[model samples]
Target: MVSIRSVHGSAQLLLDVTGGVTDIVEKMHRTIAREVNPLNRLRDMTGETPVAKQGHTYRIIQSTTSLLKQGLHRSLDGLSAQEEWELSPQSLKITAALNGVCGDHLEASGNPLAISMHLRNSRGEKLQPGSTSLSTMIPDASPRIAVLVHGLCLSHEYWKGHNEGNLGTELQSAHGFTPLYLNYNTGRHISRNGRELSQQLQRLIETWPVEVEELTLIGHSMGGLVIRSACWYAGELDLPWTSRLKNAVYLGSPHHGAALAKAGHLLTSVMRQFRYASPFALVRHTSAGIKDLRHGNLLDDDWAGVDQDDFHPDYRKPVPLHEGTRHYFIAAAIGKQVWDLPSTMLGDLLVRLDSARGQHSDDLKKLSICAEDCRVFEKLNHLDLLDNKVVHEQILGWLA
Candidate 1:
């Protein structure tokens, strides 16, 4: 069931998006036209002057633009009187996908999916730390707190709806730990998100009704990098929350680098090698968050003064696990064991085993987790690391 408001908002977004995309295509078309020289090649045969041909092309472009605008306007005018119905889950999924890809853009443009920290209750109502709101949100705030941070393109609701036993519920039932969720725009740089998270965590702690005892952080994918960034920022700023950190857990975190991002970088490099493909290379001009994953950047200085499109060798400053907090890591493989070649190569279909394990040739860049502290769950992909039974058991054992 789609609401009129959602439909109208999406229509507006589509119109703006179409304009942006067309601008790029128009530029590319001009470049192609110049290279092809189709008009010049056929000028004599067509018996047309260069000026006339140019006028014709301009008219065609204008007509197409007008038609597109008219079509969008007509669609907007065609909405039915019935405003509510049972909406398909697919529509929400599509909206979430759009947000994940260009959430930073949406936020910049003040669009519908601009994300924020929404500490939502079981009924999907937002919670606040004010006295009245706190009582309603958390009837019994526990001393121990486990904050679950979702990965790229995900909302905090992901943890709640995952097929496995809800992580927050499990921790609460087994260890008397209260759970907090963080929802954020993943399209921003990890360092940027990290700085904000550091401040937010401090506020959350300061506002807690009970005396904060122990704090544990759990992050997945890009969320892991964000946690690491937050820890570094907190330490640099001398924030009090870092002092209470008891443990940090990373699930399928690409501590070194993600191969997919590297591959995308390589593709962009190759595309830009040709003059014709140069403009189209803008296709790879993704958000800062995706770019930071190239070398697992965790500090503000890591990307200072570097042009977003320029490719540089990975020489990022090393950011280790928080010294005072015990760190645990869970890596996943799609095979029976770690030695399986395909599993090692694919590494749960996103992060490689070595990268997830924070194993690097340079000891300076390597994360210092003992072999016994790391576990590899088999027959699971990256997303499965979120809800798999074996992975959940490992998390339980580590927390215990």
Candidate 2:
């Protein structure tokens, strides 16, 4: 057996194997190398791009700035203020004006980018930051469930209940799709999260006394990436649920890669020039995914520098999507005001038309409805789409 010394998530791994210790060390070193380098060439856009890499970067930055304002919202939590929610018409409009200014960054200067998600985590709770494995409450009879894996900094709680009904609960009750929320640390490599999601899903499938026949998934923002992580994990596990997966819906999911992630990647390098940040920043720049420009949960996920897997375009490039049983892409587009109306798509004010649309997704048949006939609730923001009355209905309708 070979012993390879590694430091990932505070675990000192002495992996016992058939090979001798020297061989293990060499393999481990190679893994580290792959883990460290993703884009040999930075700004490596596809052969067919609507604009230049720098142009994409500029657009992405503008879109990112728009979303950043929402992140910066004086969040009592990721919801409108309680008192504000109860305001009279006049006060409501006033508060809206105030929030509008604060929220304007996402709308005006473009969107700010992040790579992580924020959900309230309690001590000792299984749903830790970057957590991949969770055991659901084993109801007497197996219940159909859909697992929601968020993209970047957002966590399970990202799907909040609006008007006594949240996205998860709504999916289960309205459509018999039980909701299993997964929260993983976004700072880790995509492949690490992918593997972890596989393990966790495997555990979920094996534990179910009765088979869960139909399964669906919805991912928002980077959470879309997390869903892919889980699905890729499913492929690795060869679990029944992987194929049992009936449909997948992505709202503002960046199937390829987000220019903002690249932007944040660059910003981290700049931040480093001055001083340290959030302790986690020191190790962030080691890899492109690790740098986590948007909504980062640096404290969670054990899969950072330690995991030795290459980053795939399914991890980076948005379009030319990988095939799936029933892969559905629902982009939240934020367009500029035209002659008489606002942009038909209003993504959470974070992700924009191009990024969310996965313009470059792999060679899957790009549907015209891909952008036009989508279930559009034009006034709603990105996150709002998950719980927005019409949006949830739209998700349910899509499954139908």
Q: Name the runs in model 2 displaced over 4 angstroms.
A: 1-136, 140-143, 162-164, 266-324, 335-348, 361-376
Residue 275 of candidate 2: its Cα lDDT? 25
Residues 253-330, model 1: lDDT tens digits: 989888887778778888888867877786365777788788888887888888656678876898878888989999
lDDT of 1: 0.77
- Per-residue C-alpha lDDT of model 2 across residues 1-400, encoded as one tens digit per residue: 1111101100211111112233334434433433466442232344232223344554465455445434444332233222222223343233223222222222232222111122221221233322333333333323566777665544454466445357776666677765666655554555555566666666666555567787676777666666665665565466556766777777876544454554555555564453223222323324323333232211123234432222212222222233545666665444433111334333435655544554433444232234433443455556666666766777777776
Clashes of 1: 3
Best by lDDT: 1
For each of the candidates, the C-alpha root-mean-square deviation to the true structure, in angstroms, is 5.0, 18.4
Query: Which is the leading candidate under TM-score?
Result: 1
